[model samples]
Target: MTAVVEKIHRGRKFDQVLQGARTVFLRDGYERASVDDIAREAGVSKATLYAYFPDKRLLFLEIALTECTRQTEQAAAEVEDDRPAREVLLEAAQKIAEFKLSDFGLQMYRIAVSEAEKFPQIGRAFYETGPQAGCGLLCNYLRQAVDRGELVIEDLDLAANQFVELCKAGLFNERLLGVDRKTTAKAIEKTAKAAVEMFMARYGAKVDA
Candidate 1:
């Protein structure tokens, strides 16, 4: 019982540290964020921060993973079994598109791209946790749609990637390059609808009369 209580306390402290680290990293970016700042933000001593996270890279990786996993899960949860494939896909796409355009997402993306050459692991981690995870979720949903005769996709993986890529068309690059940051909800909906329409045209199963 004592050990369990101690473990709970440790976990709480770890979460506290992570929350603090997240604030500093997002506010300062990966290159500018410092351990001292993280410690101050977390309201913990440098020793305590180091105790939870061995170094800045590992800490940043954890933060990135948390954000990516959260977004992936949120998108996946939008896929309902009873909803029409087009509706489900469009809804999921809108959510994902919005997330990709969010300030946090943009900052993390910039951090990953900027640090990719110096810290390839960070880039890999972000890809695995963010885009790859999102793709996997969509693939799983597509397979289910195929099973239900809603889609005629022979290559689930390719279709999944294509659908998401279609939804992100024009928006991701524009936002990433700072050419367009104020993308409205209507634009996102239009993009998602277009993506769904294109995907349905290619792979949607024809209904029997």
Candidate 2:
């Protein structure tokens, strides 16, 4: 039997391994983390850990990719509605803001930022899985708006990127800081509302939504 097959049949708890790996990676950062540390954290033998992930990089990469895919899918699904394009996009941004506050989201963004300069591959994969996918989902909705003459965008792709960038510029920074301040939920709502309004003003024809 193949190594991969054996690993699968070994009754390995890959999900638990990933959870422990995520904790180790987040606590130690990518460069400082090690296979032994991850193995110990996961309560698995080194052999078992290696049977699944070849190295720390691959393990962290898988974690980031999984999170990115999950968040993107959830974000896309949350914004799915017959509401106006502006409203839908704003709702998506709000959902993204909420996600940014989650432990997994913060860790993923931190990993990407810390390694992006030295390890472009990690950054690229994170972008492809997260922002790029989110933009694609948003572009699909924007294209529909264009069809109805709701936006004067000559390029739906660029518009989608711009919209995401606009929303992220605020939420991403706040999240990177962990937003630990004891701000009220009302303040968060205000911030999200303003971000959406500003974003809509730039590209929206009818901003009432």
Candidate 3:
């Protein structure tokens, strides 16, 4: 009982540190965010912060991975195996596009991109945890769809990447460039539909009634 309580306490402390790191990283970016700031934000001592996260980069990676896992799980949960390929693909695209354009997503992306040149590991971590994980989930869904005769994907991996890129369409670039950031549901739906249409044009299998 004592051991379990201690374990739970440690878990809570870990989470507290992560929450603090996330706030600091978001506000100051990776380059400017300091361990001291994160410790203060977390309401923990510097020693406690260091005990949980040895370095700032590892702390940042943990935060990124946690967020990525959350987003990936949310997207994956929305995929219905019994649904038609078009519907599933459209839903996935809409979720991806919406998340990419969201404020939190945009901020996280900016931090990753800004630090990528100086810290390549950060970029790699972001890619592996974010896009790569997302692509992998989509690829699995596509493979299942193919087996179910819903899609005819020759290269599941490539198709997954292309489908996601299609979903981004004009939204991601525009948001990244500061040209447009106010994405509406209508726009997201339209992008999803267009992506599904184009993707189905190439890989969708014809079904008999």
Candidate 4:
């Protein structure tokens, strides 16, 4: 078994190689994907692909899960910090739900799980980017909301994780288990709204009588 490389060796053909691997991984998944196939798709020589990735696992991580962190990172970028907690939290929840419920997101997760037992790093990296980073983002926004007196929460960490879970509750579970495979604009909005309402009900600062 090969050790997972945390850092990618980025060269001139880096994006080209990753683009190829992305296509193959999304299509063939981790276990069945072939380096030769990826190299062919990339239009690079086998030697060149090996020069950049060294092994299939490294390439898989780069294309499948590592860069997903880069993609999922904009969850809070457009959301203003001063916005009402309900609005900000709703936006954040929607972002989480959209990504987690997306086809790409689902693929990213499946690849991580399929490879996790053999490569623990895959699981850690997935959780770090998926749940941990998401929770951190929510914590930042929730802290701002608290500072603004929009919500009253004693445990910021718990609240952040709870909100993330709320976003994933129904449809995410269904889709992950293959019980329900479709996600729509309507479902995303509904999940986000419900998560925000529950969060606000639990934490929204009350007015004095």
Candidate 5:
């Protein structure tokens, strides 16, 4: 993880730059956002912005990584392991759907894919921090469910990854491809329910059919 840690000219305006970048990135997306826009959003000079982050990619990466961890924390914090596997899983599904269709998540995904060829680290790091970390969190909960006889999964890792993908099945593609700018809450809820039901169909041992 430390291997890809970007070196920056860290200073007083470091947090300010990060906050500014987040605002612009969410508003303008990866490609449209410029250094000047970020600087203006942050209320810092370009010299100060460049002083903290030498490259726009690095700035975006930092924000994406932080958001990734925040997403993970959000899921972990809200989901109580003591609950029935169905409840926990539904909550997880809802959270995953929320993130994938979010402005930050969509833009980050596009930026990582677009930059991967030129800066391989960007893609690798984003996936590692985002999807991979997400899978790992799901795996922990899934393993517990299996142990409790709530789920009968043979492959925790694969099942975890599959569940994450299932969460994205509805509006994710349309949103990613620029087909839909605003996804409805009803769609997201429907998708989350379907994902959990499908997952339970394969893995449930004690769960209701």
Candidate 6:
């Protein structure tokens, strides 16, 4: 009988490549960074890197997708407590803002936005995997809250998308410009409170006269 060759699942190897590519992209920016540098940093040969990703653009897209998915998942998982629906949304906004303003997170945002014309897929994937995913998760949570008689929302999905847009208003615009600005923890907290207040005033279970 002929011996069979064992399949080598290469998840860990791909992760190393992603980290190396992220480092090179950050250190040199997108235009100046070369695949050779990434391969060296990843401790893999050029051929191995090619085996994992067809080209530099694809590798970068993978990085964006991976990072976006991580942040979105973290935000969805961390949204918590028995607070009112308004307050819960505010806390969720803060967590999302904090994740969005992170170092690697910011870098991912820059590459996605700046080179979006060059790599439209990166920006599209970032939206689809990150904000869209978060919106869907928030919608599910809101549906649960509605079932429990918390928020008086009639349309959970629309409400979720609007909530994300409101949070992004204070968080996304600044980060996109690559300015010398950062979102402080206090600022994020305040922004979160504002999101809840604004949203609740429009659609809360209770409305003050």
Best candidate according to lDDT: 5
* Model 6 misplacement above 4 A: 1-12, 23-34, 81-83, 113-124, 207-209
For all predicted structures, in order, the TM-scores are 0.82, 0.72, 0.79, 0.85, 0.91, 0.75
Model 2: per-residue Cα lDDT over 1-209, one tens digit each:
11111223224577778888988977886767888888899999988887777666567767878777887777666765467766776677666666665555676677677878887767887888887887888888888777776666778888777766655565566656756533345555666677778766776675464
User: TM-score for model 5?
Assistant: 0.91
Worst 10 residues of 6 by lDDT: 1-10
- By TM-score, rank the candidates, best first: 5, 4, 1, 3, 6, 2
Question: Which lDDT tens digits does candidate 4 get at residues 1-209?
Answer: 12246455667998898888888877886677898899999999998998888788667666655555665566656768766767777877887888889776887777678888898877887777667876887788788888888889999999988888899888988888889878888988988899889888899999999
Compare candidates 1 and 3 on TM-score and give the better one. 1
Looking at model 6, the pairs that clash are none
lDDT head-to-head 2 vs 5, winner: 5
Residues 121-198, candidate 3: write the lDDT tens digits: 678778888999999999999999999888888888999999988998998888888898578889889998999999
Q: What is the overall TM-score of model 6 with all chains considered together?
A: 0.75
What are the runs in model 5 whose C-alpha is more than 4 Å off? 1-7, 206-209
- Cα miss at 30, model 6 (Å)? 4.1
Off by over 4 Å in 1: 1-12, 26-37, 54-57
The lowest-lDDT stretch of 10 consecutive residues in candidate 3 is 1-10
Q: Model 4, which residues run further than 4 Å from truth?
A: 1-9, 24-37, 54-57
Local distance difference test values of all predictions, in order: 0.81, 0.70, 0.81, 0.78, 0.86, 0.72
- TM-score for model 3? 0.79
User: Residue 148 CA error for candidate 3 (Å)?
Assistant: 1.4
> What lDDT score is found at residue 123 in candidate 3?
81
lDDT of 6 at 81: 44
Q: Which lDDT tens digits does candidate 6 get at residues 1-209?
A: 11011121245577798899989986886668899999999999888887777777667766767766776677667767466676677778777667777655676666667767775655666777867887888888888787776778888788988887776565667765656377677777777778778888777666468
Summing lDDT over every window of 10 consecutive residues in candidate 1, give the lowest-scoring window. 1-10
RMSD of 1: 5.2
